[model samples]
Target: MLNQLIHCSLNSGSPVTLTATEGLSSIAQHEDALLRHLFQGYQKWVRPVLNSSDTIKVYFGLKISQLVDV
Candidate 1:
């Protein structure tokens, strides 16, 4: 799982770019499945509150994206 997650995180961004959310957008499984295979510890803390009516907001560069999985 570590290797798979590491590979995914590396591929999520380009050679020189990194995509780590430092603040609010902390909970996510991002591009290249960076957050998918990894972040289990963080996910556990956030998932219980991610109810059907809730929404996830992500910030990339200067843009904000919203994802709602019901």
Candidate 2:
């Protein structure tokens, strides 16, 4: 689905362009290259938990108080 859009954009020479110092071979290569560029330096690991070393316990709940018949 996305590949079709990339192909159309590449063929039509839209304002948006993707280039490399060397070159990309095909549409798949172009897509992979674009993804790599887009997600470069993205981390999948947690860096800090509220900037603290100790474990934090988060508490949450909902209270309901009512007497009715409906």
lDDT of candidate 1 over 1-70, digit per residue (tens): 1122222223335333335554434324344455343443454444434486777776767768999999
After superposing candidate 2 on the true structure, give the runs of residues whose Cα lies further than 4 Å from its correct spot. 1-16, 19-25, 47-70
lDDT per residue, candidate 2, 1-70, as tens digits?
2233322243335444554333336666777877775566778665558675768677999999998999
- lDDT to native, each model: 0.45, 0.58
Clashing pairs in 2: none
Runs in model 1 deviating more than 4 A are 1-48, 62-70
Worst 10 residues of 1 by lDDT: 1-10
Backbone clash tally (model 1):
0
